[model samples]
Target: MAPTESQHFGVNMSSLEFARSVFGEEEDIGRSLTRGSIPGDMESVTLDSSTPWRLKDLELPPEPIMPLLIEAYFSRFHWYILLFHEPSFWNKTYKVYCQPTWRRRDLSDVVTVLIVAALGLQSVLQDSTWHGHNTFRIHHINHRQLLLDLVSEVRFHLIDLLANPRIEAVQVCTLLSCFYMFHSSPGLAWSTSGMAVRAAYALALHTKAPASQDRIAAQIRYRCWNHITVGDSFVTMIYGRPASVDAAFADLHELEHTDDLTIPPVLLDLTGFSECGDITSKVTFHQMKFRLYYIIRQALNRFRLLRPSQPNTNDDLVAISQEIKDVEASLAQWCQELPSLYNFEDWSLADRWAQLEYSLQNRPADIQEHAEVILLQAAMIQLLYDGAVILTHRPLLKYQVKPMRFSGSVIDSMQKSLDAVIGAALRISSFPVHKFEKHFVVSIVFHYLFMAGVILCIIPTSQPLTNTAQEAKAGVVRIIHASRAMAQHNRISRQTDKLLTELLKIAVQRETLAALDNTSVTGYHGDEAEPPLLDSEMSTTKDVPLEGPKELLQANTTTIYQPDLHREFSMDLPELLQSYHHTLDTGAARNELSDQSLLPSALLPLDPHSVFVSEQLDDIFGSLQSFYS
Candidate 1:
C-alpha cells in the first residue's frame, strides 16, 4: 500500500503545474504578465457624459475648485508619476484659464493637467482616508464620467502632440499610463508607455540636447525622460518583458540631478518647510522610488531574467553562489543607505502604518504635512525591494521542483533563494487584508503578491514539511485570504484569490493522498476520515517548533523541505489556516469553503481520480541528477 516514489512526484507535478498554469493562462506567463481587461463583472462604472465631448468642450472644474484637484494630484498621486513641476504647471494653468483662448500648439499643457486632475480625483475617491474629496463627491458630479470626459479630451489632442513629439506629450503620456494602471487597463498603460518612450526617443530626451536649448528647458527634458524610464523599466521588469528604453543612449545622457519639485514647490522634495514649520531635510518620495527602482531593475536584469546563465554547469553554480552572497549583502547595504525619511526596513514585516505612526510621533510638533504620502511610498518601496530580492533568486525554485540533493555550493545557493524568495513573499503576505482596499494597492502591488503566491505554491512541502515549507504554505494562505477579502472590489483580485485558494486546497489534499495511500477513498466518510499521524517517522519533522497548521504535517516522515533557520510567521494566519485545514479534512471542501466565501463556482472539484494528473510529468521533474550525483 506504500506510495511509490513516482506517485510522490506525481502529486508534486500536478500541484506545481496548476501553480504554473494559474499564472500561465490570462494566467499569461507564456508571454508576459497577462492582465485581464475590465471584466463585465466589474462594478459597472456609471458615466454621466455618454455623448462625445471635444477637448476644448471638456470643461475643467470651476476656478476655485482647481486648487483642490491639483493638490490631490500632487499630494496623493504625484509620487507615482513624478511628471510635473508644481509651480510651473500651476502658473501655466492660470495663464491658459485667464486668457480664455486656446492655441492648437499649446493644448499639451491643458491635456497634462486634465490627466492629473483625473488621477488625483480617482485617488481621492478610492481612498477612504482622504475625507477632503467627500465634499466634491456630490451626486451631480459623476467622478467616473468626469474622469472619462477628461481622458477623452486628452486623447483628442494626444495624437497631434505625439505627431509633433513635444515634451508636453511625453508628460501627458506618462501621466495617462498611470491613470490606465489604476483603471484595470494595464494593456493600455503598456501600449501608451511605449508611445511615450518612443516619443521621448524622437525628442532625443535620452541624451542631452545641444547648447542651443535653454539650461532650464534641458533640465525639464531630463526630468520628463526620467519619469518615462521609471514606467518603462518598472512595467517591463514586472511583466517579464524586454526593456523599452534605449540603454545605449541613456548612458550618453546619464543625468544625475532631476529638477526637484515639492508639493508646495518651496518644500522641494520635502527638503524645506512643512506643516510643522521646520526646514526638515527629507528625501522626496519621487526621488527615493526613482533611485530605488533603477537599482532594482539593474539587479533583476543582471541576476535573473534578462541575462540567464546555464543552471546545470558547475561554473554557473559557482557564479550563482557568488550572486547569492552579493544579493544578500546588497539588500543589507541598500537598507542601510536609505534616508531616515523612508527607512522602512524595520516595518517591512510590520502591519500597515506602523512605521508611520512611530515616525510621526518622533517628529517635531505632533505631525507633519504630507506624512501619509511618505508612508504610502515607503510601503511600496518595501514591496518592490522585497519582490526584486525574490525574483533575483527565483530560478532556485527549480531546486524545490525536484527536491535535489545538491552540491554544497548548490545547496548554499538554493537555500539562499528559498530564504530570500519565501521570506520576501511572507513579508508581502504579512500586510493586513485592508491593504487591498487602499489607493496604494494600485501600481501592480496585487500582481507582485500574486507572483509571490505562485512561488509559495511551488515550494516543497513533503511529509513533516520543513519549517520553511510550513511558512511558505502559511504565506500562501495569508495571500489568498487577503486577496479574497478584496475580491468583490477587484475582479482580478477575486479570480486570482479563488484560483490560488483552490490550488492550495489541491496541494494539501494531494499531500494527504500521498500519506493515505493505504486508505480507501470510499472509507473517507465524514469525521472518521481524518487519518492518523504516521508517527514512526515523526522525530525529524518534529525537530522544529510548529509554526502553522499542525494538521498539514500529519505524516511525520523525513522532509524534503529545507527549513530556514531564521524567521517564522508571527501572524494569526496560521490559526485560521488550522481552521481552514479542518474544513478541508471534514468533507467540507464543498460546503465550508463556499460558506466562508473562500471558494466560488470556480473551485476545481475534488474527484477521486482527479487528484493527481500524472501526465504533466514531462521533464518538469527536472534533471539535476548529474549535479546530485
Candidate 2:
C-alpha cells in the first residue's frame, strides 16, 4: 500500500520506461549541464527559424533547451519521488499541496531561471578577467567569434522571454542584467551593463524577493571590483602607482543599500572559487591562475619604481632586483603550467589565460621611433578600412558580412574574436612602454590598427545607440584620435585626411553609380547620346522644319524674339535678376530714379521655343518678317 522509495524521490518509472522504449537504440547521452548522464529521448534539439513560435522540429520550449533536458531527466529518474516528497514540502510550507499543473510549472520555472542565471554568471566572470586586446591585430580571432555567438543566442532567449512576461520573468530579467557586462564592444560594456544591473535590481524589488534583491545588488557591487582591478592595474602600470584605491572602492557602496547583510565576497581568485558551485569550478580555478600573472607584474612595476634611472645600485638595489627576477621566474613557470588545470575546451576560461600570457610575454617597446612605426601602421590600416567603407558604402563589411558570416554563428563569433582582441589591446595599452617587447608592440599596434578599421566602420551605425549627439561625436572623435595615434609616421604628413577625403569622394561616386544603375539613368554617364546638331547654312529643306521659331516670329518683329535666352534657361531667374539688377543700381537709385535704374513698364517674356532653334529657323523667320513688312 505504501509508495516505493523511488516514488518518494519523484522518480517516474513509467516515464523512464517510455523514454527507453522510444530512443533506446541511440547512444547514451553523456554529461550535459542539464541532463547529467541521463538518457534523452531525442537525438538533438534544433531551433528552427522558419516558424512563428521562433522554433520548430522541437516539441519543447526553445530557449531553455538545457532546462528541458533536465526536466526530462527529473521526470525519468525521480518523478514518483517528486510526486510524493515535493507535495509534502509544499503542504508544510504553504498549508496546501501544490496541484499537478502548479507543480509542473514550478519545476519548469525554476529550471528556466537557473539556466538563465548561469549564463549571466558566466558573462560576469568572463568580463572581469578581460585585459583589453593588444596581442593580435583584432581581438583574439577565435574567442571573439565564440563570444558573439554566445551573446546572440542568449539575447534571442532574453528578448523572447522579456516580451512575454510570466511569474518566472524576474529571474530571467535578473540574469539578463549579468549578460550586458560581458559586451566589451566599444561603449556597450558600460551602458548596457549598467542598465541590465539596474533592471535586475528593479525586478528583484518588484517580485518581493528580498534575498534575491540583496544577492543581485551584491553582484552589482561585486562588479566594482572589476573597475577597481582595472584602476589599480592601470594606475600602477601606466602612472607608477594607484592614485586612490579608496576612491575607487567608494563606487561599490552606491550599488547596494546600506541595510543589506548579504554582500558578495571580494572576487580575488581564491574567494571566487569558494563561492561558486562545482559546475563553475573550472571558471573559478582559472580566474585564480589568471590573477597570478598580475603579482609578477606588480613586482616588476615596483622594481622599476625603485630604480627609475636604472642606476648602478648598492647591495639593497641588487637584492630587490634579485627578488624581481624570482617573481619573473615564477610567472614564467605558472604561465607554462596553468593551462592544463581546467577544461581548456571551455573558451570562457581558456581565453583569459591565453591573453594574459600573450601580453606578459610579447609586448612592444616604448621608444619614440617604435611608437612612430606603430602609429604609421595604425594610420595605414585605418585609411585602407575607411577607404573600403567609403568606396563600398557599407560599414563593417569584412568583419560582419563576408568573413565572419562565412561562419555559422555570425554575431556570436564576431563578438568573441572582438572581445579577446579588445581585452589584449586594453591590457597592453595600460602597461608601461619600456616593459613591452618590440615585437609585441608591433603586433598589438598592427592588431589595433586592423580593429580600428572594423571599429570605425561600425561607429557610424553604432552612433545612434548612444545617449547624446555629444557621445556620438566623442566616439567618432576617439576613432579619429586612434587613427592619429596609431599612424605615428604619417601624423605630420596630412596624408591621412587626404586619404579620408578621397574615400569620401569614392563613397559618393559609388552611391551615384548605384542610383544610376537602379533608375537606368544615362545622363550621368559619358556614353549618353548627344543631342542632334542645328541645321547648317545653305542646307536644303531648312525652311520645312522651322515651325517653332516661325510661329514666334509672326507675333513680334519689334522685340525680334531676341528673348533673354540665358534668362529663359535660368532655373532661379527671378532671384538672380533681383540680385543682378540690385547690384547694377548700387546706391544711385535709392531714393530717386536714374537712367540705369529706370524700369520698363512691361517687358517681353522669353520663349524658349524662339530662343533655341536650328540655323534654318533664322532664314525662315527673316522671310516671314519680309512678308509681314
Candidate 3:
C-alpha cells in the first residue's frame, strides 16, 4: 500500500475504522470494536425470538427525563464506581434517545441506556420530591412500574449474554452486580459479579488496555476492568472467596479522568461543593479505592494462612506474625502518604465523626446542602482504611476468642485486633443517620458497617461495658435505625436491618447474663455503674431468637466473659492501634503504642548510597573534631 492508515496515523488501525478511532466513534461502537474488529459474539441474538426485550415495546421514560436521569447517575454513582466513559456515554445515549422514535440502534447500547436511566430514576426518586411529578402521570406511565419493567427486560437479555458474552455484557453485568448487592436480588449479586469477572477475562481485558491508537478506548478498558476486578476484590474481602484477578491489579494505571463523571451544575448548586472536582478529582477517588483493595487483598492472604477455623499449632500462628506486621506496615504507610484531605489520623475518630455530623446539622451560609459527593467520598475512603485495619488484625481476635494462652506477642496482636475492629465499628455506627442518601447506600459503606456492626455486638459481651462500650451499643442501635430507613429502598437492606437488630439483642442479653444479679444491659460493673439504655424491647433479653452463632451467643465462652476484668474502652483510633498491651490476668489487655507505632518507622528500605554517604560524613566530622581537639 502507498500509505497504510496505520502508517498515516502512526498507530495500528482496522481498515473499516478509517480515520475514526475510538475517540471519533460513539461509546457503543468503541465498546464493540475494542478488539479492533466487529466481534460476532457482541451481536445480541434473541433469547426468545417471540418476545425479545425490544426497545419499541418497553415504556421508556419521557424524553425530557432522560437527561435528568443521566445527570443524576453521573453525580451520585459514577465516581463511586468508574464504569463509563462520560463524554462517550452522553454521545451514545443522546444518539439513541434524543431522536423521535429512534431509527437505528444496537440492543446492547439500548440496554445500557435503559439501565442507566433506571438507576438515575431511582436516584432522583430518593428526594421524595419526584414521586408525583406530573410528567410521569401525564404520560400514563407509573414510575415504579417503569423501573420494574426496565429490570425485567435487562434480565431477559442478560440470559442471552450469559451464554454469548461481549464487552457491553461486562458493563451490564457489573452494574447489575451492584444493583443486586444492595437492591433487589442480593442473594444472587455475588454470583452475578463472578459472571462479570469471567466475562472480562473472556475479552482479555486483564492483559492490557485494548486500544493503541485512541486514548478514550484505553481509558474505557482500564475502567471496565477496574470495576470487574475491584468488585471481585470486594466480594473476596467480605466473603473470603478467592480473587479472580488479584494479579492483574499490579499492571493497572490509575483510573483515567472521564467527562461522564463531571458533576452537573444543578448538583453542584445543590451539594454546595462547586470546587469538588478540583479538590479531589473523581480519578483520585477510584485510584484510592483501587490501591486500598490491593492491600485488603494482601491482608486476606495472610489471614488465610492462619486459617482461623483450623490452626495447626501455636507455632503456626507465630510464624505469620511478621507477615501481619508487614501488611499493617503497608496500610500505615498508605494512610501516611494519602493526600491530607483524605488523611484523618490526627483527630480522634469519634470526634471527627461528631464534627462531620455537626457540619450536616449546621452548615455555613455558603454551603448548606447535605450529602456532598466529595465529602462522602472522604468518609467512604476513611471507612475503607478502617475496614482494612480490621481485616489485617481480625485473625488474632479469632484465636483469642477461643481462650487459648500463647506468647505475649499473640496477646498483643489480639488486643490490637480487638481495639481496631471495635473502634472502627464505633466510628462506623457513629456516622449520623442524616448523612448519605437514604434510598441509596453505597455497597462499600454498608459492607464495612456490617463488618464493624458484628464486631461491636460480639466483642463487648466478653469484655465489660465501659461508657465507650455503652455508646458503641447505642451506635449499633443507630445502625439498626439507619438500616430500617435504607430498607425501604431495597429488599436486602430490610433483611440487614432485621439481622443487625437481632444481633444487638443477643449481644445485650449475653452481657446482661454475664453481669448477673446486677442485671443491666449496659452496666460495666466498675466504679459508678453505667445505667442500661435503649429500646424497651431490650429490657428483657431472654427468649430472644437464638439466631446468632451458638459458640458466640449461647455458650459462656471466654468471648462471653465472666466480667472479672474491666478494661475501659477509652482511646483514640491511633491509640487503639498501638502495639503494646498492659498485661492482664485474663490475657486480654489493650495499651496504646504511644512509644512507637504498630508499624515500623520506615515504609521502604533505606537506599544503600544514602546510608553509605551519611556514614562517610559522620567519619569525616569525627576526624575533624578530633584534629581540633
**The candidate that achieves the highest lDDT relative to the unseen native structure:** 3
Query: Which regions of candidate 1 deviate over 4 angstroms?
Result: 1-66, 127-139, 209-219, 251-285, 303-332, 347-368, 399-405, 432-443, 460-464, 514-629
Error of 3 at 594 (Å): 39
By descending lDDT, how would the candidates be arranged? Answer: 3, 1, 2
* Whole-structure CA lDDT of model 3: 0.56
**What tens-digit string does per-residue lDDT give for candidate 1 at 1-629?**
01111121223333333555566645543223212121222211121123332365686665545567667777656555555666677777546644565555455666777777777776666555665555566434666677788788887778766755567878888877877765748788888888888877666676556678766566667778777777777787755577787554443223343344333333323321232232232335555566666766566556544343444454555665676566667667777666644655544435425544554564543134455555566677777778777766764444212212345666556556666777788888775446435553453677777777766754432321334545566777777777867776665577568666755654454333222321222134455554454564342123322232232334223222332211112112234245445645664432322222110111122454433323322122211121112
Give the least accurate 10-residue stretch of model 3, judged by summed lDDT: 593-602
Residue 103 accuracy (lDDT) in model 3: 27
Worst 10 residues of 2 by lDDT: 396-405
How much does candidate 3 score in TM-score? 0.67
Q: How would you encode candidate 3's per-residue C-alpha lDDT over 1-629 as one tens digit per residue?
A: 11121332225455435535645656345454443333333343343233433463566666776677677777667757777887888887557555444322355677777777777766666566653356666777767777778777787767656554556778888887777776677668888887887777656566545345377777787788767766777877655567666462334556665654443444344322342334324566677778887787767666666543353455655655666788888988877667644443432345653554465565452233223555566667887787787777665454432233356675466556667777777878766435566335454466667667766766535542344445556667667677777777645456657766655655554444333312221233456654553354343333332132222323322232211221222222223323112222221221111111111111123233321112222321221123223
lDDT of 1 at 374: 56
| lDDT by residue (tens digit), candidate 2, 143-225 | 33434444455454554443323323433333333233222331333333333333323222212223444454343334333
